[model samples]
Target chain A: MKKYTYTEKKDTRSGFGAGLHEAGKKNENVVALCADLVGSLKMEAFIKDFPERFTQVGIAEANMIGIAAGMTIGGKIPYTGTFANFSTGRVYDQIRQSVAYSNKNVKICASHAGLTLGEDGATHQILEDIGLMKMLPGMVVINPCDYNQTKAATIAIADYEGPVYLRFGRPTVPVFTDPDQKFEIGKAWMVNEGKDVTIIATGHLVWEAIEAGEQLAEMGIDAEIINIHTIKPLDEEAILKSVQKTGCVVTAEEHNKYGGLGESVARLLATTQPTPQEFVAVNDSFGESGTPNQLMEKYGLTDKDIVKAVQRVLERK
Target chain B: MKHTTEELEEIASQIRRDIVRMVHGCQSGHPGGSLGCADFFTALYFEVMHHSTDFTMDGKGEDLFFLSNGHISPVWYSTLARAGYFEASELATFRKLDSRLQGHPTTHEHLPGVRIASGSLGQGMSVAIGAALAKKLNNDKAIVFSLHGDGELQEGQNWEAAMFAPFNKVDNLICTVDFNGQQIDGPTEKVLSLDNLQAKFEAFGWHVIVSNGNSMEEIVKTLQYAVSLTGKGKPILNLMSTQMGYGVDFMMGSHKWHGVAPNDEQLKLALDQLKETLGDY
Candidate 1:
């Protein structure tokens, strides 16, 4: 397994904020709208830097989405910020009709995704956002792993035309990825190369996959880890090549196992190459009030969960 | 181009005829609101807005209009065609299979003069506010206009948008609500009462005006009066009163004709009432 190290731990939301601040300076057309969660979404820096370009939409997610879609008409690229639940499920019809179906160039930047939202509980923690967003036609769904990658993806999505959903978490995790990495939308990053088992992970689970690879290596088992960030328009070829070499794959994410990255992988494999796969995700259940680490451990979203999934998939193969 | 009320009235009568014909052609669509808003759509397209015949999604140099109550698409489609955005003959293809004229207005069909897709109600106001904000950003002096149904106001998003526009000083938009007391279910009053709508808008910090929507002269005057109130630190609202299915003798003063297409006998009677002043496509 490849060695990975980081000196700092930061929330992916902060990376999004940093990237948004940079994108504001980079492009004149980039504008932002936040629905009463500017501080929570870490949009303070961007709001401070470009006051004229930001709109504080006072707790109306649907209205924020509609306004963002409309701003695209006169050539303004609008990014709406809110919690994952409010951003996706609450204003789905608005995003669908105005942004996705209308093909508006709007960026829906969501923070506090998955169980990582912690103590606020199930209402705030949204696990079905990836499925909700990816189902929309012509929508680009991205869930970057670390702080640096989240920031890079935030900056990159600005140049991309059409609707995009950028999901990030509130928990401060490992900042392992390069700070200067340029984000590629649909390309998967191969974290470590191995021959025995393949591990594909997204969002915060990506770090766990890397840790799992190291653990599996200690156990005399070689594991190949791939970070599949962009869930929709998934990097199928990268996954297939890695799985073809390893002969089996394990998919992990901080989402519902039924309709998330695992389901996508399962469909692709079923159609092209039916291979044995194990899923490490929340199995159709809601999260409760707990610390981010506690919730992750209880819900089977940690490094050990990924390691077990890899072991199981290898056995199946 | 400034058109006289007499000329606008002539066009409105033709547009009403077109609305009936288009709905009749598809045998499915919302016609009640369309018939009532014919005069307002005609006046806005021909007399009020500074628009281009060559339609662009980013209407930079011209006034932009959004049909928030998009069920009333027939009036908008006919108005756009008459204003030279497309051929009047294409209006016949409304709500047909593979036609640009959807049941509700949509930009998906690449329909000229449409910026956003809306059959779902209460979204247009926010969209209009965004465009108006963009115009301010670009330093373009052109205003934005949007039409809504009074029934659509029951949606909470409109209130959210209502609060946003005034707070942000979105003064470049003039929104009109077709206060035709009818919807899909029944009379709007019985379905859900929007009591003292003028007072509601006033409380929302909007400059409110009232006029008869079916009257060409009043629609022209009220729209001009509403425009005059713009750029003074508040968005303007016009409470346009009209009876659903106004032009048709049998369908007027009721909600039964809201979505149902007219039968052969009813179509003939409706056609007789609305004269073919402009040549029918």
Candidate 2:
């Protein structure tokens, strides 16, 4: 088995902002629209260079989706930015009708996703966004692990046609992925390999999986860590191959246990391999204002949780 | 290609006939607004708009029109057909299974003339504003046009777009409001009075124009004037006055036929009044 180490930490949203600015320089058709969150979404550079292309749709997410859909009709690729809660849940019908069902070529760039959107609490944190977005017919759901990957994925989806839901988060985490890595949409990134158990994680949970792998190694439990970036087009081939070798799995994400990455992996395992699986996610409850560390600990979403989940699933195997 | 007064009336009469036939074929569509906007749609397709005979989804390097009040799709379909965007024979398939023309105009069916699906109200303005911005981005010079019902302005998103377009320098878009003063429930005044519509648009930083939408001469003249107002850094709006259910004798002056297809006897009478100018599809 192979291992990797992290030396720096950065928020995924900053990566998205950097990627968006790069996309502006690369593609002429790429235009951005934010619902009055220019500074928050880190779209300042894109706004600065191409001031005419950037639109400020004030506090109106639904109208922003509608306008983004319209912008695609005239051969302009539009990226809509806002908080995940308001971006998906608040404007589901608008996205459903105008973007997804119509099959418009629009990029829905969302920030502040999942429980790691610390201090804003449950009202702003959106745990069901992945489920909601993935359920749409033509929607591509991407949850990048760290800053570099987030920036890379943001730039990648600009060229890929059709409707896309790009989900990133607040709070800086491990920035282990390479700065210039070519981010593919549905391909899983394998960090390490082992025979005892497979850890499938997404978003902020990828680093947790890596930490849990190191912990499991001390106890002589060899664990494989795979970062599942694109959730909707779940890399079924990679997942099945890993689960076949390991015979058990642990899935982790900064979202609810019911509908997050864990549930997606469990669904795949149930029909295909029938492997024993455990989930490291926020239990069925809303989060309150707290530091990211406190919330992860309070909700049992730490590396210890992943380590325990791996052991529990191994017991089933 | 200027149409004389008599020719304009004939074109309007033909559009009215197509509207009846389309709604009757569907057995479920709004006919009153379609009838009311027949003259305006006829003028745009047959006389006013500079359109391509070969229909493309992206109307680049040419004028583009969007129906913000998409419930009036029958009128648009009839006009598009008369203008040769599609075969008139396809009119019989309106709202039928696997029809390209859905209950509302949708691009999902690969309909050549439609760019976006729009049955949802309050969304068209923003879409029009976006298309206008796209025109600016492309440096295409061609204008973007949109039509909305006066009552549909109740949707808050319309205001968001209204506040946005003018400030964003979306001057190439000309928005026309069908101030027919009627809605599904009743007269717009009785349902919800949108008093001073022209002033309301002006307050939102638009250059206001007024016209009798049902009159071909006024419609053509006002739209031509609207064309000249492009590239001025402010959106142009036309407060178009019309009569709900304009041509039909019995359906006129009320909101009874807004969403209802006429019965057999009523359909016969309505068809008889609207003479078949280019032959019914």
Question: What DockQ results do all the predictions give, each relative to the true complex?
Answer: 0.82, 0.65
> How accurate locally, in lDDT, is each candidate?
0.92, 0.88
Instruction: Judge the docking of candidate 2 as incorrect, acceptable, medium or high.
Output: medium
Error of 2 at A152 (Å): 1.0
lDDT of 2 at A171: 89
Q: How many residue pairs clash in each candidate?
A: 0, 0
Off by over 4 Å in 1: none
**Model 2 RMSD vs true structure:** 1.8
lDDT of 2 at B71: 89
lDDT of 2 by residue, B1-281 (tens): 57886798897898898888788876789898999999888777777777797877668898889998888999888888888889888888988999998999888888778887788787888888888888888888888889999999988888988888887778999999998888888888888899898888899899999899888788888888998998888999999999889999887767888999887788899998988888887
Which 10 residues in a row give candidate 1 chain B its minimum summed lDDT?
Answer: B1-10
- For candidate 1, the lDDT comes to 0.92
Clashing pairs in 1: none
Misplaced by over 4 Å in model 2 are A270-273
lDDT of 1 at A299: 98
